[model samples]
Target: SKLFGHLSSNSSPLFIMPTGRTLTRTEFVKRLREVISSFGINSPLYSGHSLRIGAASTAAKAGLPIYLIKILGRWSSEAYRRYISVSSSTISNAFVLMSKI
Candidate 1:
């Protein structure tokens, strides 16, 4: 399947699996491991779950409101906090702003 193109249900699956269905957790894990290996990453902590966390964290870093991030992530409860992460740069910037106030 093409990596970049307009996609519709009639087109190739947004993400293809050898079995042509939803990927099993085992398959997802294997693929993530391979990609991480290719990148020479040495962390044991990255997986499919990281994608969700990264997306929520990225939206937060981009300054999107928490309510909107929750909605965009389909999070219905305060559990959204578990998915988002704040970076050190953001922490430092907040401290700088606070000091000026």
Candidate 2:
């Protein structure tokens, strides 16, 4: 019996324990840590929210428009702006580009 497997007889739930129960937040976090650690990221600081932040940061770095980034992140408020973390070089490059105009 797999702890997290779908019973072929049932197809409603995408993920469920052998007991047909959804994972609690703690269990989910533990599994998240295990997966992260397997990838050589043993940091205890990673959480579910980290995924969201990473997505926003990556999109911002990729030069996606702010409106599109907000749409991709499903952020209705300006809170998504805070999730974007740009490198100092990016800022310096922006200033250089601005001066060219």
Q: Compute each candidate's TM-score over C-alphas.
A: 0.64, 0.69
lDDT per residue as tens, model 2, 29-100: 788899989989864989877877998999999989998787666677999888899899999999999999
Q: Which stretches of candidate 1 lie over 4 Å from their true place?
A: 1-20, 98-101
Predictions: Cα RMSD each: 5.1, 7.6
Model 1 scores a C-alpha lDDT of: 0.74
**After superposition on all CA atoms, how large is the RMSD of candidate 2?**
7.6
Q: How far off is residue 84 in model 2, in Å? A: 0.3
Candidate 2 lDDT score relative to the true structure: 0.79
Q: Give the per-residue lDDT of model 1 (tens digit) for 1-101.
A: 43323331234334566677877677777888888988899636788778778878898888889987776666668987988887798899999999999
